[model samples]
Target chain A: MQVHELRLPLRAEDIRKLKEGDKVLLSGIIYTARDQAHKKLIELIEKGVDLPFKLRETAIFYCGPSPKAEGKVCGAIGPTTSSRMDGLTLPLLQQGLKVIIGKGERSAECERQIREHGAVYLTAIGGISAVLARTIVSCETYLWEELGAEAVYRMELDRLPCYVGIVGD
Target chain B: MRYLKAEDIQKALTQAICQISYESDPKAVERMRTAHEQSNHELERDVLGAILENNELAAIDNIPLCQDTGCTVIIAEMGRELVIEGATLQEIADRAAAEAQGKCPLRASISYDPLFRRKNSGNNSPAIVHIRQVEGKRLKLKIAQKGGGAENMSFLMMLSPATPLEKIKEQIVQRIVESGSRACPPLVVGIGIGGNFERCALLAKEALFEELGRKHPDEHYAALEQEILSMINKCGKGAQGMGGGLTALAVHVLHEACHIASLPIAVNLQCHAHRHVDIEL
Candidate 1:
């Protein structure tokens, strides 16, 4: 029921007080990645390829939004079901990604990774596409343009609403 | 013979798909609003708000309600005397479905070889089409864009004919409680009774396309629907399972004659975003 304000490059301690149902308003950067980008990112990490951005102290949002029409930063962006990314979360956690923003329940392995890595998973209200879209102050494609909606789009978000749905505690 | 052109049916199908994705049936929307009003818990309230907001955005922006636009499933009824001309009915339906998926760019959820090398079919093709012949000449098509989440929660029960009606009701409500937020509660519960196993399950799923809160013409079945809805909502599953108000907005029960020894029951859970459209051509 408590709504906390979060800043970019959030620390583990900052998210430690949160539980599975606490809501928060987050401001700062988030990177978008869906199934394809996740596959590629994990593969790159396995092959020791350099990542475009530092995974440490960053929140990854699982989303695949519609194309930008007109001057909008993105179209109808919302958190996707999180379970699909269970395979990638552990490695990303090991790589220092501290927060995962998505919808739905996480796998036990993902929760274990979060606990071990001092990370958390936050849930944005699912189906609030336009509300989430309005939080995007800016967005740019960082990779995998040909993947269409699955392409990674780095976002600068302001006062985005999310609930800490899974905690290390 | 009552004649219907293939083109008319195809166009109607396409329009039905697009319309349902954004504009939910009025009855379903009304029931959702009522569920929101009755709910007391914050989490359930929040999920309801998000769902309502999604509906608004989808309509205002002409976007599909959910990214998973779902595989094309058409329930078509034609009069016994009606004739479909110009192309095979199935072929026209398939082509229309492909066109709808592409133009709408609905998520390509369908995969080829669902068992082994599951390759994306690219166009969400090979729609699930059900046809039945009736006595009237008028053609009716009902469409429901079923998401994977709720579809995965569907279950069938081979209940003994002697099983108490109360127990059957308990199973349906318990299934929703177990599903919690997984099937996206404040769901629409569809129950099929009396048919054979597979047919019963299909009947339950098809029943979901009916207007929310609408009851069966059969008085006994309608009473059961009301009872189930009240019981399920009282279970505290609430919207998206965060707790508080109604777990389900409606309970639709459909029944058919069956073998004397068997009472096959099926439950098909449908999320609150229940997208469906109807066309009479």
Candidate 2:
């Protein structure tokens, strides 16, 4: 596997260069969203209201960090199963979600949409939460405090390692 | 009659809870290392290497090994001869589990109920405790912080008693292979081959507590375990389903006699990050 260091806010051209089995160490910003957050975010999108973060030319990690300790920026954070969000994903990619990072495979519908929208899917090793969290430089809850861990968190990551699972034509 | 304090059980349970949260069982660690060494895929190797490193870092940094610290599962084997003072075991376990949940601040994976009000119960309390009577005076507790991912892939099928053994095994291998990266290969799979509906599921879970890859004592079941392991590994799911030589670290089987008309089987899966511990009080 060839290792590549890539800065996030992945664009159409940058995503095209990635292929399956490539090891990517990503740095820059990402928004964390899980089950509940996906629902709320999509709801806002349908209502034509402002989203907590821009969805274009960006990446969203399907994970929730553990509660940070008193002095820590974040806790153990790992990719969740992407298939769970299959229903909520196409809209985001349509709005220009260039990259989706999570563990496991996506449903056929999501995979088709990923290719259609020129998006890339990446998977980090699941359960290695603490190791992955070390890559995060900072984390702040961006929206949905009521959802607690499921709330969207804006995270600035440095060299977060992941493997490309799917890439567009 | 000898009496043991509920506090003692609480204290022991508290320690066991934390031990699993921060560190995986040593045998589990050893199996992972072997998987890492054996896999041919570099992607698989790389991920396994990171997992092994994560184990060490989690201990050093005092953070949980996984964000999904999982729902607390405790199987308590109580001796018939021993007497308990203070609260019931369930109550003791709940309090101890709550205290540990606060200390580790493990995610509140549990909800108030399964449906309707799907709300986080906050402190990961009300541990799913299973108790049974055994022969010895010692109380044995098998605790696992089982995450939802692999457990979601666990399966139960009531195959026809008249069905051939080969077909039953094939069905299991097929479903598990279909799980792909979802169940978090390389996994430690616990399989229960016989018993009633619920008992079969319980047997599969109890089988997980058995020493990681230890074979069944019965030669027939041992051979079955080996066969299943080889077949599953040969599927090329490898570590994290990256495709390689290893998929499951171990496949443990436990079988019991079932009703003449029934043949129920349950497969309980544990991800590579199994935070499991055994405590004797």
Per-model tally of clashing residue pairs: 0, 0
The local distance difference test score of model 2 is 0.87
List model 1 lDDT by residue over A1-169, tens digit each: 7878998798767878787788888888889888778988999999988788888856798877654556556655666667878887887887888888887777887878887877888877655566666677887887987665577888889988888878885
In terms of docking quality, how is candidate 1 classified?
acceptable
- RMSD from true fold, candidate 2: 1.2
Poorly placed runs, candidate 2 (over 4 Å): none
TM-score of 1: 0.89
Best by lDDT: 2
Kindly list the per-residue Cα lDDT of model 1 for residues B64-118, writing each as its tens digit: 6765566777788878888888986677767777777766646566666787855
Whole-structure CA lDDT of model 1: 0.77
lDDT of each: 0.77, 0.87
Candidate 1 clashes between residue pairs 3 or more apart in a chain or in different chains: none
True contacts kept of each: 0.14, 0.70
Chain A TM-score compared with the true chain A, each model in order: 0.95, 0.96
Query: Which is the leading candidate under TM-score?
Result: 2
